[model samples]
Target: MNMSTTSTFPQTDGVMTPRRVAGAYLAEIRSECLRYLRNPGFMLPLMLFPAVFYLMFGVLMNHGHADAARYLLASYGVFGVMGPGLFGFGASLALERDGGLLTLKRALPMPPGAYLLGKMAMAMVVSGLVMVLMLLLGVFAAHVPLSGAQILGLLALGVFGVLPFCALGMFVGTLIKGQGAPGLLNLVYLPMAFLSGLWFPLSAMPSWLAAIAPVWPSYHLNIIAQRVVGLSDAPVLAHVWILLGVAVGLLWLASRRLRRHG
Candidate 1:
């Protein structure tokens, strides 16, 4: 006598209900947040460095100069937010890919975007914390005069302003090895901050340097930030458009690379 057996598998599309999709994203975000929270080495520096800079430059060095404190607050806030976007997305993604975690995530029963979204949420959380610290130092410690609306505006900017850097970092992550990601990102980060006039007003830089400052995304962000703080009357629309274009372009390129390489 002979026996025959047959097996049937569930269709992949049938498993992805809206409720499950939402849960997957939430779970991923929670895990990502918890993982970073547990890593004090990473979180401490990411959160503290900007506050330290703000305290040193905006408060102590300024010696109660209202205008200088206000200016540095805007500049350092942009500088602060850039770190998480670049390091959180760029370094983490590259390291996970190298460690085989990214592949395992792809093989798991979760949304394709859950991983990236989780990291993005974590970065925003860090960015918000850093921004809040900067604001507190600016308001109470440094005595920079910021109205309620201005404080809220800068907070909102700090939260969402990380996206452009996230896209750029994502692209860079896809292009480099895990070990090289941090170094390469720092190369991009610090120099971009300086060249974008995040440390000093463009007017204070060389004529050629000031002329090229507009080429950096941070310059536009700083412009908008200064406007938020009532320090600059520069038009905001052009900067917004430029940033939006840069983010979309980098995200497009990053997605293509991830699909091909991963």
Candidate 2:
């Protein structure tokens, strides 16, 4: 059989039912999650860096400043979520594209969306883990006061906020060679984190530097996150809309690139 030809699976009544589609999606998600978890090189850094950063900045450095702890908790949570989305999607997609795995997947009976969905699912799961760890440290270790509602809201936002970064990762993966993806992602990731006020307040920087915040999705995410703790006065919906727009635009660009490369 030609590898380019789609494989056929057993079906009932010659129709793909909702149950079957759901099963396929679950299978893909499981596979992706396992693949991510098994890679210590990837998973360790993704899971550890954010937590460590939170401990250093949000806990130790905050030095009994509840306000600072609350701020860093939210900022680091956003930073934590960005890793699994940006690096996960960027590196995985680039490797798959280079290894011809994408072509093989295309020939399979799986829904095309399953590939992206699996990645998104993995990123969200990791995001949730990061948020939980951060929350524990913030509430107990750092003594950051947060109501139950605020905690829940922060977790929800962190998980969903990975969408734009995932789209961004896909775009970057499609644009670069597989071997260079990691370096490229680090360069973009670290600088964006600093510029977007994830590590510290952008207001402390030069006015011109602070002016660049809106250009990065991370900045908008931080704005909404800060708003959750009463640090920012910007409308939450506005920041969400900005992220939604960026996600849509990046997804479109990535799809176009994939089509050309495919």
Candidate 3:
């Protein structure tokens, strides 16, 4: 008896279907981000919050701390970038999960990777725009006094720092019911920002604040930015490690949650 070998061949339906699903996800994300942009009132508040916080803490009410502008710029930049990650992506994830979007995706034949990949891509794009807004506020409006290299470094800290928090936000969205999402998100974002000293340098705050600062994701994120803005020549390995660890941990948790839900 001769055994017949199956020849490898491309499946037409397989190709088009996944492509269309991925495309649709992309389109949906773009639509969501653009909706925020179209209404400046919503996005503008996010842009202004960090700047206001920086000014209120680091300038107008500062107690003559060392390098206030530079330090505050970095901190606010961290807080600024995280807005899109938490508020933006959190809301998106909440809406999708609550509306049975992710559940629906479970029935589809497309690769599961596309669901997450599309969200991450969307998050990056939206966060990038918010970063630009924060950068302008830090530089021109706030007068943070940073160099070109420092500027780029802050951007890295801002963008890279969002990853873990975004993952965490997604996980949170998964856990909470829809009606409680917005309030729950605010509860997390506001306290974490203050606790992390995004409004003031931990050094100037209570010593206990500094001790607890590292535990908040914003602390490590801002630490890198502070070094970049104020101590541009300092080694950043430690800060980078912190961001990576947070991102990895959150991502792992988010992945597990997604699998369980699916």
Candidate 4:
């Protein structure tokens, strides 16, 4: 009877193996990537806005100033990353939540982290494409000279820097309705860009206003990008820690809100 039962049931654990879990996670990431790529409204703005701005300000109106071109290259790179991180997490998640998508996803047998991580992976992919396009424009059109190391460093920072913005977006998504997310994101995105000096130098602003530069994550990110391009000498580790702290805190808040609502 025991042998017959074993033969019928099979001698195996019910839990998924690590490889199976990883496959599922990767599948989720692929789905997220495809979803974002298929949406022209999302993809177009994300790809074009930064490129066009770089062309107009960094290349065309750069006024024979090589330094200006290089500086804008770094600054616009920061600007490039912000769009994917903010809108990807904020607007997308809010829409999903309001449309009952998240509820449906939750009912699936997949791991919860898969969903969040998939979204993050998608953002990273989009952010990476933006970085590549910006760098290409900087090299070919703007003629901004950068060392191989500097280019690599800027790319790395651009990818990693999406975290704090994702956290901020998640927090915003959890708090607002889907319909309001795009408007709210624009309100946050543009002000933060202008205030953080992504469009211009903070030093050009009033001293009091410049003092608030450190208050924005984008400012810190720009500082790091500048350091990569020999534009700033600020302490790098301090900026890294500040971003880490902000990401952690915002993620905590977002998780709490999700729990309450879920």
Best by TM-score: 4
State how far residue 137 of model 4 sits from its true place (Å).
Answer: 0.6
Between candidates 1 and 2, name the one with more favorable lDDT. Answer: 1
TM-score of 1: 0.93
What's model 4's lDDT at 149? 97
Best by lDDT: 4
Worst 10 residues of 1 by lDDT: 2-11
Residue pairs clashing, model 4 = none
Error of 1 at 213 (Å): 0.7
Question: What would the per-residue lDDT of candidate 3 be over residues 107-176, giving only the tens digit for each residue?
Answer: 8664556666556655666566667766786677656666788777766666566787787777777777
Those runs of model 1 whose alpha carbons end farther than 4 Å from true positions after fitting are: 1-14
Count of backbone clashes for each model? 0, 0, 0, 0
Q: What is the C-alpha RMSD of each candidate to the true structure, in Å?
A: 4.0, 4.6, 6.7, 3.4
Tens-digit lDDT track of model 4 for 21-50? 899999999999999999999999988988
Q: Is candidate 1 or candidate 4 better by TM-score?
A: 4
The residue ranges of model 3 lying beyond 4 angstroms of the native Cα positions read: 1-11, 16-32, 35-42, 58-66, 232-234
Question: Per-prediction TM-score, please?
Answer: 0.93, 0.92, 0.81, 0.94
- The lDDT of each candidate is 0.89, 0.88, 0.71, 0.90
Clashes of 1: 0
Clashing residue pairs in candidate 1 are none
Query: Best to worst by TM-score, what's the order?
Result: 4, 1, 2, 3
